[model samples]
Target: MITNEYINRAIDYILNHIDEEITVEDISNYCCFSRYYFSRIFKMETGESIYEFIKRVRMERSAFRLKVEKDRSITDIGSAYGYSSSNYSSAFKKHHNMPPYKFRRSIVHKSMMNPVFRNTQTELLTWQECSEKITVEIFEDCTVIFERYKGSYGDLSVHWGAFLDKYKEYITEQTRILERSYDDPAITLPDKCLCDICIDAPAGCTLENICTIKGGRFAVYHFSGPVEHIYSAYQNLFSVWLPQSKYKIDDSYGFEIYKKTDCGSRHMDIDICIPVK
Candidate 1:
């Protein structure tokens, strides 16, 4: 969990409202602090000024949409964040070193080379085998306390361990360990990935780093395998199964609900839930 309540509140405001026009004054006022004081603490803790942080996050989220939401026009995606077509192209080029259309092209081209498309003799399972693991279900909305992590997904074990240890006193047998991913690993750079290591809010927990996961209809895949193969599982779910299914993905962020884990055995059991329309 983020230790600074003010910074957490500011980040929360930014993330929850990133698609809308945002300003430093809006965040400062939301946290009930002066703009100068809030900006100083935000930079001190996050290593980026409030404006820089907001811009980077907005750009990254928009970049992800460019890759996945192929049917969405660049102008519409930019307009969601209050950017006009010309301004959006300029800002996107400045940060990503390419225009939005070019970035989308690059990701799509790269996706064709994924391991899922490779031919192998008895080395890869059939598409039907992979699709069989997915099922549809309705997920109820829930609030959780989470800590933000910005790095490779492989480093998550350490972060999860630390979170559990730090809040052990508040944890019980009923606690649910879960995570929410903000970027697609295959599309986004490894170091720039963002995720939240979370658990269901503890009893009487007063943590400020809390948010609600949207409840909706989802395609749930029950994945049980080595931690390293988790990414492959997601690829199969999205690339192979999704295209054939009647449903299309919704705008909601997907989350993983941990069923169990075996550190010594190097195994993980979890339900990967993707919201669908």
Candidate 2:
């Protein structure tokens, strides 16, 4: 079996050298595994090919920087991630459906007009009043059976209901309801966002859409509020808390642990778990 430690090491190596040229052989050697074996195991564990993962990460990071580093030129941002101007524009447009210049302009325009975006910093300062509590905890690695959904975040409930109905047999007292969002709606178009609703399952559980959540240290922020406000909470987490905190974000995508959901009242209580180093 591929251990979490080995995967973590590989991920760490990737993040540290993301701008440099990385080869499958280099990663496989780092993990002390043969090329073919390492590639297969990595895909099995992470639900994506190594090259795809690297490309996606670089694109996402570039997207984030585009939003925050307003003064930086688009060409510089693209080059920083090892993409030339034309190639970067092509790759970014293909993934995000818009050019980098347009994406950055949209963020700036939205921030100016949207009250939620304008008040993110203030909201973060008073987050304790609206949130339950933030805590740091260690989580264990586990397997999950999930169903994927795409499109607007508002339509997730319909998908969740269907996923539960289809996989009710897997439900148990110990089963955790987890949601993994692969795209940032603020960066990527809402229609292109991808989410997965999942339930914890037994180890070695082979299902149609099974993935392993890499376990390690995480900063968990407990949030209790209307569903619409969740995005702001995340904005605060990334724009405010994370920048000020000593810990840096890890390679693993942060996920939400749903504790309670009441669609009738539009209330939710969830733990936003961000992987940290």
Candidate 3:
């Protein structure tokens, strides 16, 4: 079983130094373990690596900053989050693709789309009991562009791929003018309707250009995992765990929190937040 002591101590260190250079070695020394041993245990328990975990913590903080701190420049914000000039560029490129400056203008000013879920199946399934500390928050109304989908989500990568390619192109063109992003909320998957969630997009964006998608309110949850196994977490949450919890499922947006995606670590750092009532 995973102990709260271990998780809590790690979290405390992480929260304190979110803006500092963090590594497996730092965590190892803090926890009094060898780097090799700490890496294995963290992966085994969280399904993610130490480096990936820290990057995620940083990215999450950045996201909030982006939403609230309009005064900070992207480079300033990036550096505040412990990213070097090159590192910030690389990280922003991987996540937002068009760099922070342009991406900022689009998200900050727009009326973002929010998806809402009205009804859910009554049947409840049992899952292995495990709880991770999750923080929940509410976002006000906003604007967005999105693409709607319904199908076997596992095989829908082709669709997402096409959408991403177009989204990137749109951002490149509009970067000089505004900050544009392809927001993905990966809810409505297979097993039930085999559905795919929509993408929040920007203006000058069209189906051909990957423009405006949808906008709405959301109740978000953060977690970490490999990209492939992420679906299992959702399955457990929606089908088994959430049904019994006090939180009611709403038809807003559902999205994954992302950290790094590179050869060094394929473990996807994600926050799976679904808008609920």
Candidate 4:
């Protein structure tokens, strides 16, 4: 993960205004570095040039919206990212290997609320169990230091351990460990997923990779089980409970606050929080 404050600021800007037009020159100037130098170091630390990273994030987030915001029209979704309908379809197909409509269709069919489906992949929660575990709650904004990791979600424990170890000095009784995921696993390929393992930062800490987590309304589910069982919780949460709820998921991004962790047992006590409107 990059500890460069300049790159961190640039990434924050990109995510905040992902719906708006962005250019390398704009980001370079915002970081107060020459465009060439900023681009070079960003690529060196992130493995993707500035434009490539922005494009990938836009594509992933748009694809995620396709899954969640089913009532929203494709044209409107594409337009939000400054893509014309035709261009969006072409680009989405090239990036995801299928047109946007098909991708949405597949998700609908795949996530049918089969009682048996919950038993298999999720291996933990029935509809009733999930219903009992979830609630709508408000969250306060927090500043956090995070390490962005890209790749398979199933293999993140080692990365988490290393990051926590590196920043061990900052840990405290009141601190919270959070994991903010930026892509839908069902849509984005496992190797291409992006996430951050983060912890609350103290005031005026001056950490290099720090950013504010803008908090608001959230559907927070309390879960305690083997980490493998989490798949079912999420499936049941979004596929079942969320659709029936009065609230709609907003674009603020969902995150997990780890209340307890036992990596050796592959177990966790975590609050799964998804932003809502």
Best by lDDT: 4
What ranking of all candidate models by lDDT puts the best one first? 4, 1, 2, 3
Q: lDDT tens digits, residues 114-204, model 1?
A: 3322331112245688668888999898888888877778778889888989777767899899999877765556666668888898666
Across 1-277, the per-residue lDDT of candidate 3 in tens digits comes to: 2233454356457756888888778888898889998788877765558787687657655654554355557778788887877888778767655666666566422213111221322222253352342445665433333344333444444665565565565444333221111122222113212132234445544453232213344444444644455545554554444545556554333554344334346365655666566
| Whole-model alpha-carbon lDDT for candidate 2 | 0.74
Better of 1 and 4 by TM-score: 4
Residue 174 lDDT (model 4)? 91
Model 2: worst 10 consecutive residues (lDDT sum)? 113-122
Supply the TM-score for candidate 2: 0.65
Model 2 misplaced stretches (Cα beyond 4 Å) = 1-58, 65-80, 84-132
- What order do candidates take by TM-score, descending? 4, 1, 2, 3
Candidate with top TM-score is: 4
Instruction: For model 1, state the Cα shift of residue 246 in Å.
Output: 4.2
Candidate 4 lDDT score at position 36: 96
What local lDDT score does residue 184 receive in model 2, on the 0 to 100 scale?
63
Could you give candidate 4's per-residue lDDT for residues 1-277 as a string of tens digits? 5567787778878887898999999999999999999999999977889999899889888887777777789989999999999999999999988899998888755644333223445443455776789988999998998888777777778798888899999999998999998766665666767788999998789867887788899998898988766666676676667766777888688899998888679789999999999
Model 2 residue 263 lDDT score = 80
Off by over 4 Å in 3: 1-4, 108-111, 115-277
lDDT against true structure, model 4: 0.81
